[model samples]
Target: MALAVTCSISISSSSSSSSTFQSSQPKFSQIASIRVSEIPHGGGVNASQRRSFVKPPQRSRDSIAPLAATIVASDVAETEQDNYQQLAVDLENASPLQIMDAALEKFGIHIAIAFSGAEDVALIEYARLTGRPFRVFSLDTGRLNPETYRFFDEVEKHYGIHIEYMFPYAVEVQGLVRSKGLLSFYEDGHQECCRVRKVRPLRRALKGLRAWITGQRKDQSPGTRSEVPVVQVDPVFEGVDGGVGSLVKWNPVANVKGHDIWSFLRTMNVPVNSLHSKGYISIGCEPCTRAVLPGQHEREGRWWWEDAKAKECGLHKGNVKQDAEAELNGNGVANTNGTATVADIFNTQNVVSLSRTGIENLTKLENRKEPWLVVLYAPWCPYCQAMEESYVDLADRLAESGVKVGKFRADGEQKEFAKRELGLGSFPTIMFFPKHSSRPIKYPSENRDVDSLMAFVNALR
Candidate 1:
């Protein structure tokens, strides 16, 4: 079921398309300074900033039209369910452009292209090739690289379309940063940060559309996305009328290879992020992403410290199904080998488990007999899990020393108090309580290796 809007295009200028594009293009700095907080909750384009992004000049029948396509949504609720499985099978081997055309014709304004400011610009080119009015939106995670921000500006000039930008809620961002500091995700897993910055904003953006197009492909991450269908009912997100089957996802380039995407971009002369030329294949937030080596997979460049099997952020959690070994136990900790309990995972002999009251009591002590080293952690946190072995080793080495090693589960019910007083922002926050003072010293670095942690305890103890 589709709600269509026919947009009228007009030519305000008779100048050459190239000259008009060059002259109208705004500087990258101008686009970089855009205040995403002003864009509202779901997504919106600011009227004053609209002039900087105008339609492309007239082109040949094969090029993007010089006219801009405006999309308006219908208030009608979607009630019909299409045979997405059959459609996926039929379009299993179709070209990217053909699949894009099909999606536009079927969903129109109800659908939007999810632009990642990467090679996915090819999706916009294909949408233009179909001459259909399409909507485009992106998540401004506030931590994107400078080159990506510039590319956003370039695409606006090249396509003559204003992108609807979505931003994370200010309260959530401020809370995370204020309690944990800016780079907390480096020590803990990236899930919490990505959830706050990327996934939640994307969720808000998708709520306004019935269907959304993506540039996902089987070649992107073989471990997680090996079975991406061309079209399917979105299992992860909801639409305008929010429910179980209220949304549909169209992956037009699901079967296209990465090299072919770059080829299409190069051939079409589409604007792309400058980081791609610097060996960074899969781009996300600036901190978690890096350049890959010669033979490494693109996913390797993102969250390089994490295990290969669990590379995906929470945005695409639906793509990776959990097996027994990867499933969480009753306490939400990963039950590796299907038999380990929560106690077994944090079963370091020297590390004392502190309860909420216990931690409160420790904080009230005017003078401690021995210096205390405590870790504020959550069982479900992969970052906490990643540092488990090292923390245990540190505890063992410090057992003979005067320092006392302990851990406090600061998640769930106690999270708010931990945030307010215990300096808990992300998982596994380490604090050192000195021998003569009640105040505790917080660990500042993201490095969680054994030697670094050992040095922290040794220097304090």
Candidate 2:
């Protein structure tokens, strides 16, 4: 069973040859006034104010930054010569949290960063040294093995930075468990588990945050080759604000890739993960991790069985489906900031940040008689294309008429199951699943263009 890489929104840009859209960002916010960051000296702000990011010098064909830590300001300067010294000092000795705090103090916003393993320790050390707590902190979806945990503990002790965790929402996890338990991920392979645990958590963790950072590097993967300075919109970060909001992700270690991270630790005199000396090129949760052998890419250890398509755990590199209703339309996207738009509702890149900690609604959703049409379309499917705007419009009309409308996508590896349960005949299919009913009322294969598609959807019982 080939795990066909599909996107919920397509990012049609200069680079479309590959299905996966690299994490390169095109920020639209002002450098000094980024929404979530607060920098005292010179970081800009606002939705349309992010053009001053002085991107690091490109190393090679590869150079993707992480969502965990973004470059809030590229050209920050208190004094020309003094600012240069400050940046140099930041690069030389600053904790991950310190870097984040400094950016926030300067830019007036928050940021994000992820920990694959010990490499995160360096980020932590920087945070500790500079007394700057990170804006966002997370771990991958795969289960972490003992060694990795031990190393994490060691780093916490060494740097005293309490790393925050981001996981998938329990509601979805329970839903998955009701359908398939923990072992189901193994049977379903990487993508399904990634979607349920990793991707969903990242989505929730990043909700409402302004800027996100990552520990990503283009050299890490062949897929991340054509990275750019700033991206206006991306497929993976769909359904969120402007989709082109400022990305304050900073790769302090961009110049450092494929090198011995553990060796660097020894040089820095940092406590190292004992296992690094062995062969663990990439360190993440244990269940889905392993040690990369010689003559292999760093990521070769992560889900060695799956192809590049299945390797992603969802939070980092995934597809985008832009054809759906614009997240801004329909019932009207709620006004959050002064400059609210459809992009923020959907394609915003802040990954899942689970709140309401320990409080979960376990009760199953009691089927209701209210009419609804659950959409089961892949981001890559053409049928679901351009359906977002119509859906939002329909949602708007329904709300005005006192009707409830909802959306659901057939993402991950379970589309086959959806096809079986919903009797899907083609892509971009929308089945009317009325409330109080257990199954969906299948629609016929008819005119699918915008005109009839909305009409058929409007007539759902």
User: In model 2, what is the error at residue 45, expressed in angstroms?
Assistant: 14
Candidate no. 2 TM-score: 0.45
- Give per-residue CA lDDT, model 1, range 267-363, as digits (tens): 9777789999998888988998998753245776788766444578876787876655476432343545654434424567799999889899899
Off by over 4 Å in 1: 1-80, 323-461
Clash count, one per candidate: 0, 115
Report per-prediction Cα RMSD to one decimal. 14.6, 21.3
Worst 10 residues of 1 by lDDT: 48-57
The per-residue C-alpha lDDT of model 2 at residue 272 equals 69
Error of 2 at 407 (Å): 49
